[model samples]
Target: MTTAAHPLVVRARQLATGLLGPHAERVDQEGVPASHVKALKGSGLLGVNAPTEYGGAAAPPAVARDTAEILAGACCSTWFVLTQHYTPVKLLASTELPVRERLLGPLARGELLSGIAYAHVRAFPRVPVRATPERGGWRFDGTVPWYTGWTLNDVMLLAGVSEAGEVVFAFTEAREQPGLRPTAPMRLAALSAAHTVSLELNGLWLPRDSIVLRTPQTKFAQVDRPRNTNASPAVFGVAYAALDLLEAAPEAKETAGSLRSRLDEARREAYALWDHPVPHERIEERLAWKLRAHDLLRTTTTAALVAGGGRSMALGSRAQRLAREAMFLLVQGQTAEVRQAHLGHLSEIP
Candidate 1:
């Protein structure tokens, strides 16, 4: 069945299809192709989620999902980079007007590409590569182990632990800063065009005015609040895309059917929650959505490989890259136990 096509989805499909010959391999290797980036910027497609005030298409979360799914079908690396920029733009939109004017405008216009340096090993909390203060600014230090689109980004949303043990998000220009250093890009099994690398920030000082938002105590609570509905559609879209890939494989009939049925169930549950008046209940619902989405994609992709008699692992195949990219969803947040607990709650939801 043809998915209901939005205008953005149509345009994205056209762009993805047109660029496939030239960009498909590059995106698989580089994570995101330069040509793809240029095209997306020139076409103003990157701003689909940016607010109208910032000269963006200001499309809904569903548009973002559709766009991502379309792009992923052609180039997973580009979709990865696009999602990185899109999420930060959504976060920026929630900030004060001055911050929006200063950062969001250029970002929405596609003149700027961005990355995030947020992850750190849990054992070394003090070793987090970036940190900001409670009241105003931040003093960033440490390094992010895996920073995607580092070379292509004009800016980055650097996150670090604060003095008070809170998490802070700081926006910084990539080129101007001497302290923020990018290492050579790493070779990955897939999503090569993403330009993933390590980042080092030593004694980087950002003033209070540069601070976008901070979450005290639990960082997840502040940034990924229960009410943040912007990410659900994107998660759904990625799962749908992976499922679409599986469905196209003759060996994947049974697997695809099972995955699609599960996804439809989860989608219905999520949409029902969305339509309800429960304000903070969405946090759990989003977690559930991500968990189920990840499971469906992982299971379907793995099943497709087995059913395809190993031909799916050939170079330049969509299934090959998707198999590698599927691993990303497993490492996202919380732990196995936490995910299980969340799953229990989700399972219990009538």
Candidate 2:
């Protein structure tokens, strides 16, 4: 059922348009049904960014980005669940740790799914999670405020700051274990179907081999800067979906036309900056494009909702769903600098 021309892309588009898009509303209400995840596993898109030697598609960066755009536009909850798997794959591929041999193959093959409990590390000075040297490994203690894919993941990439100010990351069983506790999944304004939870680690320990990365916290910051500055392609995808809705209505054609033109312009600029040879160049321009894209996203989604008239008020309406997703993307991968810039930009509006 797959074609030779970009098989992974072709498959992802088919899954997005068929299984994911048709069932998104129900999946959102049900918090990502099991059948949907099973379809995703068979799609082979989960391994898009992993190394080919490890059974991943090993698609190009642009291919991965386009796949994300398609999936997020179809069903963000499902996209988020799978997105967490890529980071650990990247970490394992980059690190020379012994655990790489143990986990990378299975994860890349989609035989196992992983979630991230590492965002708390971004709260640097606060030290939300801390690691102390122990006999055979390291002991982790403190709280993780946001851990998505709770019961759905097989493992998690957990991170904490060491007493010596180093960032330590390790893979651990995602289930409840001694000294590790998880709160029930949270309900949010959007993407609640992702099954997010908070984790509390009290003397949780991981063997030395399980530890994937350990470097000075400053080094992590250096690697993290360029990533946070880039615009997410999902922003463009979701905005386009709303534009599609607006385009269907005769009255909103002109508004949709103008926003579509602006969206394409900003998207090209953002993608070009993101793909530049230098990883850290033109960060300011990248952020500018990000804000511009977000503005367009807001305008398009709101217009879609307005154009839907009284029907938009229904909980299952695409216009309503897209509107809520727009809210979620506004802060999905937020950093302190991005937050400051976004808020500052809003404050300047006369």
Give the candidate number with the greatest lDDT.
2
Off-target runs (Cα >4 Å) in candidate 1 are: 1-5, 20-22, 119-127, 130-137, 219-222, 225-255, 271-279, 282-289, 333-350
Q: Give the alpha carbon lDDT tens digit for every residue of 246-312 in model 2.
A: 9999999999999999999998999898899998788889888888888888999999999999999
Backbone clashes, candidate 1: 16
lDDT tens readout by residue for model 1, 98-160: 566788988898888877766553323455554745345568888778788776777888777
Lowest summed lDDT window (length 10), candidate 2:
1-10
* Most accurate candidate by TM-score: 2
Shift in Å, residue 33, candidate 1: 1.9
